[model samples]
Target: MQSFLQVKHVIDYSKMTHIHLRDFYASLNKKPQPERVKMLLNYLIEDQRRIEKILSTFEAVSEPYILDSWMQYVSNVDIHGLINNQKIKADISLDEITELAVKFGEVLVNFYREAATKTDLEKVSNIFKNLAEMEVKDNLKQARAALFEEM
Candidate 1:
């Protein structure tokens, strides 16, 4: 049986995700293919919107000082590994890009869900649970969009 330990580790992945999305967006922006660039720009915009939602959640329950400190703890985490293992390129098909984006969302959901389960504080757990649920909803929206594109 697994034991629940009182771990006070709170990771703020907002900065990391922003940087990752910016880097990916920049790469896509440089591509010669207009259609691909447009597709990725749309993806990036939606990603930014979702990140804002997560940040808003934190704002609702956390002080500026605590949130600032949590942001600084990004170095302690291997966040890039959690997002996606694939190197995104502009040449990739829309389906491939969608798959990669979905994978990133999945990782976010899994990370938050795990954190929610591991935390000793109800408030912290609930925050993480909410984040996970948001990610799930975002994934469903992406799936629906993909389905529409297929039709």
Candidate 2:
């Protein structure tokens, strides 16, 4: 019989996700132009929304820290998407932008898969599945396109 001791250790996306998410948001902050800032901010807002949803779905015990961190990150973002009618931003090259996005997505997936192998908890397993799906949905394809110069 298979034991429930199949708990898997998840990949520590804490540092990586934080770093990449910060970079994406900071990319907007670095934009001196109001228009570019506004454009990127819109994308940031959407990402914040997605992150919130992801956090909510996580089956972790300490919800407060996770939620707080996500909230703080989103809250500090400048939301001026409405102010700029002609916003176009660029910090990373288009190719680089896609590459990083996809790489991060892959890391997320790998983290979940690794965690699943290390933990026996069904909840943790579910969490990994959800997290993996979220990452796959986000930026994996963009990275692939960027990597292959297909886009």
> Any runs in candidate 1 off by more than 4 Å, and if so which?
1-11, 34-37, 60-77, 82-85
Tens-place lDDT per residue, model 2, 1-151, is 1122222111223333444465555555576634433444445445645665555344254344332221101112111221222233644444444444455556556655554444444555565577667667766444444445432
> Could you tell me which 10 consecutive residues in candidate 1 have the lowest summed lDDT?
67-76
Cand. 2 TM to true fold: 0.50
Query: Over 4 Å off in model 2, which ranges?
Result: 1-20, 32-45, 56-91, 140-151
> What TM-score does candidate 1 get on C-alpha atoms?
0.69
Q: How many backbone clashes does candidate 1 have?
A: 0
Error of 2 at 121 (Å): 1.6
Could you tell me every candidate's TM-score relative to the true structure? Answer: 0.69, 0.50
**How big is the positional error of residue 119 in model 1, measured in Å on the Cα after superposition?**
1.7
Model 1: how far residue 61 lies from native, Å = 5.2
Instruction: Quickly count the clashes in candidate 2.
Output: 12
Which of the numbered candidates is closest to the native, going by highest lDDT? 1
